[model samples]
Target: MFDLIVLSVFNGLIYGLLLFMLSSGLTLIFSMMGVLNFAHASVYMAGAYFAYSLTPYLGFWGALIAAPFLAGLVGAAVERFGLRHVHGHGHVAELLFTFGLAYLIEEFVHLVWGRNPLDQRPPPLLDFPLFTFAGIDFPAFKVFMIVVALGMFVALWLILTRTRIGLIVQAALTHPHTVGNLGHDVPTVFTLVFATGSALAGLAGVMGGIHLVTNPGMAQALGPIVFVVIVVGGLGSLAGALIASILIGLLQTFAIAVDASLADFLRLFGLQVTRATPGWEVWSITLAQIGPMLPYLLLVLMLMLRPRGLLGSRDS
Candidate 1:
């Protein structure tokens, strides 16, 4: 029992960190630019594909370094040529544009990569087991994911709170004219923020393509969860996003790890429901079956109890 729980904790940490890698980028875009980029996950998918395509030419290491940068450049171009044109039309327009862009990006991926999931395995250098705990071996690749996520989190916090460029980026949305008067280009800042956010997503993709699945449906699978993380953490709060990511990650891990069913849950309280009992159909279900739906459930509960999220400000 203890071993199962321990294993679950480790799994939860890895899952949570992965969520952070994706959510942090979304959070940065939202908090800095005030744009709810619907295509963020699509960009992440593009990054994964970008890395995959580059691997043959550059090898895994080169692709890993280059793909995110390429993704960033693509993001900058989108903001400059596509999104900026729609910026004048208000948030609804921005949302619609990005939402459409997401579909377009998905179709493009499908047309180019086909519907099959890529055979994107972890690089040979990091494929071995790093350690064993609770009789389960943890992979080095997953440990790398954890380290990268943590390093990015710390680095982002420092850059945002302690750096001059961070100050300018943060202020650009709230005080554009003021920033412009100070000799900074507000539009350029917005482009940089979008690119940076996309780059973060791309970075996540480079690792996540292997950590998770790399497929055409990859963006659709994760897009909603990223939004959930951001909303649960707070609309524009990076710290909130991180906390929510871990919470959701742990919640999901435990749900899938536990062997208890609704029937077992009742038996724990000396109550047993047989096949003839009322709602047997429901009671027969196991928590592992509920794993996929847990995040949305938490999302609903979060909205009801505290709509702003775990660490969101009242105004946010």
Candidate 2:
């Protein structure tokens, strides 16, 4: 049981870190531009579909290289054309525009990829198990996922902290007017940040497509969950996003791995309730049944208790 718990925690950490990859970009864009990108997850879905189409001809690695570039280009175009035009309309308009873009992307994906789940698999090299502990096997693909996520995290940290570009980005996030006064092209910086964020989403989509099933509805399915992560992690705070993502990931993983029921609680208290008894249904609740809602539940609790989020400077 202890081993199982450890394994579940590890798996959760992997998922959370992947989520952070997507959320970090989002938080940065939000901090710098003050826009909540509703279409971010849709771009992620596009990455998956783009990879799927590319895999038949170019293979997984090729798709991995090309899909994110294409997605980033798309993001840049959207910012240059669509967002730039809409920026004058205020924050609500910007958000609505993104929401509309999300809907359009969903429909476009259905039209192009069809309204069905596509079978996506990792490269043949990643098909086997990496190792086993306490008689439980861990797949090589999952290990690869952890490595890739960690590498991205380290690279991103270095770029944001060590380079001139990173310094400019940080300044833009906190003092955009000052940066602009100093002759930096603030709009250009914003566009680049938006594109970079989209690229990160694309990377997550490609990895998730290989790990999870890909379908036309995948965007809509995961969209709210990502939003919850952003809100729970605190708006515009990358560190908060990292913490929230891992917290939600582990909470869900452990919730599903455990098997205890609410009935166990009643028994411990020397109380009993029949199936037909009023309020007795609580006794029938199982961990698995509630596991899926764990993230949302955490989001609600966090919002209620700390509106600014764990590390956020402002309310989401």
Candidate 3:
């Protein structure tokens, strides 16, 4: 049990950090642009695909550096050519545009990479086991992932809190018009933020592809969950996003570890639910079986009780 607990916590942290990688960019984008980009995960997918294509020629390390920049360029193009045209139509138009963009990106990926999952293995150098504990072998790649995630977080914090551009970004978040009046090119700033956000998503994709399956469906699978992280954390709230991601990740991981069922609960109440029981099928459902449902359940509860999220700004 001790070993299981330790392993689960480690796994949860890994998953949570990955979630943060994906969510942080979205939160930043929303803070600066005041619009949610539904296709953010698609950009993540593009990154993975780009990496897959580049790895053959550039190798994993080279692809790691190149793919995200390519994805960022794509995102910049979308903002410059596509989203810029739709800004006049209001937020709804922007939302729909991104929703459509997600579909288009998926289709484009399918057209190029096909619907099949790509064989995205980590670099051979980092493919070995880091350590063995309690019959569990911790992979070097996961440790690398943790390091990468922590590094990204630190760099992001430094950029947002310690740099001149970070100060400008913070100012623009609260006073875009005033900042523009002060002679800052707000439109260029917006484009840069979008590109940076997309670049982060692409970085997530590159790492995530190594950990999970990379396919055309990857974006579709992860898109909604990423939204849940930010929404539950709070829109435009980086701290909130981080907290929510870890909370959800740990909860989901622990929930899957539980083997108890409704029948087990009923037993403590002096009841026995068997195959012959009226709702035996429902009562037999184990926590592991319903683990995936927990996030939505938590999301609903959070929305009902605290719509602004844990660390969300009141004005945002």
Candidate 4:
């Protein structure tokens, strides 16, 4: 029991951090540019595919470094040629452009990589077990993932809070015309933010491709969940995103592990849950069986109870 609990915690942290990696990029984009990119996950997919194509020649390390820049460049192009043209049309235009752009990216991936999943393996250096405790052997790749995720959080926080560039970026978010008059290239700043956000998503893909899957549909699978993380964490709050990601990660991991049914819960409270009781069918469902439903439920509760989100500073 102890070993199982311990192992589950590490697994939860890994899953949560993967989410943080993905959400952090989206958060950066939204917080800075006020654009909730519908195609953000597609950029993530591009990164994975980019890594898959590059790894054979450059190996994992090289792919890790190169793929993000490639993805960032792609994002920069979208912001410049695609998103930029639509900027005058307002948020609806931006949203529609990104929404359409997502489909375009998916089709491109299908045409290039086909519909099959790519078998991406961890690098040889971090492929083995790192240690064993209470009869549980933890994979080195998983450990590496946790470390990279944490390192990314620290780096992003410092970059945004402690740097001169960060100050200009934040100022631009609120006062673009003033900043532009002050000799800063506001459009260029927007492009950089989009590209950097996409780069962060690409970095997540470089690792997530191996940890999860490298396929065309991979973005579709994780995209909604990433949105949920940011919304629950608050639209533009990095700290909130981190907390929500961890909470959801832990919730889902433990939900999958626990075998208790809703009926068990009612009985625990001396409610005598049985088939004769009202809504017995729903009560009979097991936690593990309904694990995927929990996040949405939490989302609904959050919206009703606190619309601003966990650490949100402004109204959504």
Candidate 5:
């Protein structure tokens, strides 16, 4: 039991940080552009696919760096050519444009990569076990993932809070016209932010593809979860996004570790439901069986109780 607890904690932290990597990019885009960027996860899939294709010639390390740049470049193109044109048509048009773009990107991936999961893996250097706890081995790649995520989080925080560019970005998000009037090229700033956010998503994809599976369906699978993270964290709040990602990650891991069922609750009140019970199907459902749904449940509750989210402000 103690070992299980220890393993669960480690797993939770890993998953949480992985989630933060993805959510941070989405949240940053929202903070700056006020656009939901429905194609965000698709860009992540593109990164994973790009890495897979580049791994043979460039190897894992090269692909890790190159793939994100490719994704970011694509994102910049989409922003410059596609999104900018749709901006004057209102938010709905922009949202619909991205929604369509996501499908196009997915189809393009399917055409190129096919309907299959790639055999993506970490480099041999990072594949070995880092440590063993209670007879269970922890992989070095997970530690690397943790480091990358923390580095990104800290770097982003510093860039936003301590730099001149950061100040300009914050100001632009709130007042694009004002910044433009100051001759700072506000449009260029927005383009860079979109590209940077997409690049971060790409980086996350490269790391996560090895950690999870690199399937063509990967984007669609993770799309809802990413949205849930940002929404629960507070739409445009970076700190809120981080806290919510970790919270949801821990919640999912811990919930799956427990073997409790609704039937267990009935027994506590001197009532028991057996297989023969009329509602046995429902009562026998274990928490682990529905762990994936926990985040959505929390999302609904958060929306109902505190729509602004944990760290969100009135305007956020």
Candidate 6:
């Protein structure tokens, strides 16, 4: 039991960190532009498909390098042509535009990749188990995920805090008008930031595709969970997003790891019911069964109790 718990926690950390990689850019984009990018996860899906396509020709490492670059370039084009024209329509319109784009991208992906799950796997070098604890093995690919996520986090932190461009971005987040008055190309910064954020999402998609599954519906499946992370972490606060991601990650992991029931807890309290009541479903009350919904449960509770999220200043 203890080993199971430990492994679950490790898995949670891995999952959480992957989520942060995707959410950090999302939070930044939201903070700077006040645009909730509905197509962000679609961009991530695109990365996975791109990587899948490149793996045969370029190999895994090459695909890792090239896929995100392609995604970022696509992002820049979207911003330069699609979003720039819609900027005048207010945040709601911008959001709707992205939402429509998401649907279109999904159709495009289906048309291009076919409506099926790809047989994607990690490179041969990363195919084996990394380590074992209490007879449970951890895969090398999962370790690779942790390494990549940490690298991205460190690089992003450095670029955002230690660079002159980072300073300008910080300024633009708060005072775009002032940054513009200072003779910096604020729109250009916006474009770069948007592209960078999309690239990060694409990277997450690529890595996650190997660890998780890559399919026509993968984006639709993961998109809501990513949104939950951003909302629960707090809008525009990377730190909050990080914390929320870990919390949700651990929550789901542990929830699935431990299989128990509300009835079991009630029995311990000497309040067990003798029979199943009408409309009662055994699986409905099982922790493992409801594990998938844990994140959404936390999302609703967090929004109700702390609308500003763990680190957010803005109204959630």
The clash numbers for all candidates, in the given order, read 0, 0, 0, 0, 0, 0
lDDT of 1 by residue, 191-246 (tens): 88889888988988888898888999889888898888987898656788889998
Backbone clash tally (model 5)? 0
* Candidate 4 local lDDT, 107-217, one digit each (tens): 999999999999999999999999998899999999998999899889887877899887777677566789989998889888998898899899889998999999998
What TM-score does model 6 achieve against the real structure?
Answer: 0.94
Query: How does candidate 5 score on lDDT?
Result: 0.87
* Candidate 3 TM-score versus the reference: 0.95
| Candidate 5 C-alpha error for residue 11, in Å | 2.1
lDDT of 1 at 197: 84
Candidate 6 lDDT for residue 304: 91
Q: Write down the TM-score of every candidate.
A: 0.94, 0.94, 0.95, 0.94, 0.94, 0.94
Model 2: per-residue Cα lDDT at residue 81: 91
Q: Candidate 5 versus the native: TM-score?
A: 0.94
**Local distance difference test scores for all models:** 0.86, 0.85, 0.88, 0.88, 0.87, 0.86
TM-score of model number 4: 0.94
Query: Candidate 2: lDDT over CA atoms?
Result: 0.85
lDDT of 6 at 191: 90
Tens digit per residue, CA lDDT, model 6, 176-236: 8999999999999999988998898889888988878888787888788888898888887
Better of 1 and 3 by lDDT: 3
lDDT of 2 at 56: 91
**Candidate 2: clashing pairs of residues:** none
